[model samples]
Target: MTRDITIVGAGWAGLAAAVKATQLGLKVHLFDAANAPGGRAKSVAHQGQLFDNGQHALIGAYSETLGLIQTMDLQPQALFERQAMKWQYPRGECYALPQDAYPLKALRSLLFSKRFSVREKSTLLKPLFFSVSQALWGKTDDTVAHLFQGVSPKIMRDIISPLCLSALNTPVSVASANIFMRVLKDAFANPPQSCEFLFPRLPLSDIFPLPCLNWLRERGARIQLNHRIDDLQDLDPHVPAILAVPPWQASLLTHDKYPQWSMLAKHIKHRAIASIYVKGLRAESDSKQAPSSSYPGSLMCLNDHDESEDCVHPQFGLQRDVNASTRNSHPEGAEHWALIVSAADPNARQTIIENALKAACEQLKLSDVQLELCTVEKRATFSCDAHLQRPPCWIDSGLMAAGDYVQGPYPGTLEGAVRSGFQAVTQLVDASFVSSHAGNTSRVL
Candidate 1:
């Protein structure tokens, strides 16, 4: 039989699967309920200015994602501004990894960072080395907080906590240590440049999904936008289908035919990510001035004490300076910035945005600021806890699953999503090939 694949959802995972399937000589049909392609990572235009759903950051470790972008002929250099990894805190402490070279730069930075005392630096480095070495053997499947039992409280609050929330979208106290270690290993254990940061210059949609769609369309793949699949049974049984929607949506789509999978999907918990886009801020005249309370780093972590019952201390992104050129090209006049809050409370979204804006104004020395937009993704990512049980890629021979929430080494990230998509399509192709060969042999006999 001729190989064909039907993908439900036009998000990163679905797009990845479709692209891979098409490359493998399989006819592909991709569907999405949205008018556009990108799901959570898409862009929206407000008053002639573009803003993403959230501030999505990327690193060199996103190999699959980079490869997919390359496959689509989308230049990563054009889409993103690559820089050295810098973890700056609002309190004026910074731990920056060198952009020039890997392990050497990392070691040098750790040893020479002015932010930590000798003892504090040693305390931080020892655990990281231990964790990396332990990862080689086998990591403990415990919470991150539990894993770093003897680490200093200062390191936990300043470094580990922020990194955990940003990476896993889960608090260190509850996030899976094994997964966290894997992320760290991938990030730091590789070549020196692997630690470099890639900030999207364009909107998330423009960077991947839209370009991917165009590429797929050019390759004769049928893509249907604003198309919702209400019933999985409606799809052709001869052609394998990949469900790349969120867990809840997947549960709804597969509840009848795949009851067990539906149950597993339903059991998966999720976390929220909130981004507050503020306008009417003035750009800093002097870029070289020392970091101040009213002028924090362009990207800085908030202290725990700054958090409230309804709001977590967000990682602020001052796009005012960075987007100055873009703003000049566009009709929008005001300076814009984004504050990303992970695991945000939906009920207190307004309060969270308000608090974040207030904090930004006070810290960044902004005299006048107006809220442009506030986007909250309530089910942004699965709760990456130690005990979380994600659904597998191969749901059945005819039906497969692909999404960030599916079983993977890393947490629910863009890399995880893309990797899952490729994995699902590969599994489908392999199964089909095997089945075809077996049937041909039986017929000959």
Candidate 2:
């Protein structure tokens, strides 16, 4: 009889595991409390328009996520619009990487960037050299602030700090330096395209989650939605199970079975992400106001530390034409703008949205913006602080766990979640194969 594998949680990690396990010819059973999948990365429809729980950015370096997308038979070109790395701030400062070659384009972009002073540009080399060397040897396991001890304050404010907040969802003062360095290594050390940004043309759910769910269902996998598994022991012990829920949920489910892992999961703090959607902004009719032909999309990084206090409102901003896609069925003449606030406060969500919209309008030279929708994910991602003790995938011989919070080189990201899923599934498959082989060998003896 084929070995049956039960998976708890229908998020990216769990879905990825289910797909891989199914491919391996295992009977797969997946469960989640939510009616639909995607977990924190999911999308919702409000007033006939679709929006993600939080605005997420993807880079070419996200190999695992990209691979999973391909494996699901989704064309990357159709799902995302790829562009070279471009960081446009509200203060008329832009830093765009060239599309030519690896180190050459990277160096050229840094040197030509108007955001950095000549002295600061020259100083940037030291950190780059150090990071490259450390990538080969090893990075210091400390706060990201300490990692760039002698770097210019300008570089830190403009580059490192934003990158840290966006990637790790933790402030640079406390984020893990090791993970930050690894991210940098992956971005610059690889091919130039690896540094390119991938903006989803569709809602994030359409990009991965819903498609993955359909793929699994069509393959004869049993999925139980809105079915919360309160106890792991309730399930049949003969079938191995993978718990791919959030860190907090995982803690609750594993407390009785694996107290140590539960403690670790409970200890893991979480960071919040708030996306404030605004509408009624004027589209750029003037050629001067429009982005270059190379960058047709509206993507901007908010100048969160300008002389004006209001400028430091949103961490990042994205503007999408509502009529661009027929999938969301957005009303005509309506535009959607999302301001991503990292480490957001739940109580002050309305105030945050208002401030963010004001800042965004001021920067984009638009007036009369209207607040359309505001969404906040309080436990969007686990805090990736220095020395953060994340729970491992293998909780016990018969049970495993998978999520972005699972101990990995990456922080809380789609890639991290998918990679963790693959890792957990591999562990389960390997153990099962080993056991079966051992049993056969013993019988032969």
- Model 2 weakest 10-residue run by lDDT: 436-445
| TM-score of candidate 1 on Cα atoms, chains taken together | 0.90
Name the runs in model 1 displaced over 4 angstroms: 99-104, 283-298, 304-310, 318-334, 433-445
| Candidate 1, poorest ten consecutive residues by summed lDDT | 436-445
Model 1, residue pairs in steric clash: 102-192, 294-363
Q: Model 1, 308-328: lDDT tens per residue?
A: 222454655545333621344
Prediction RMSDs, each to the true structure: 3.8, 3.4
User: What is residue 388's positional error in candidate 2, in angstroms?
Assistant: 1.3
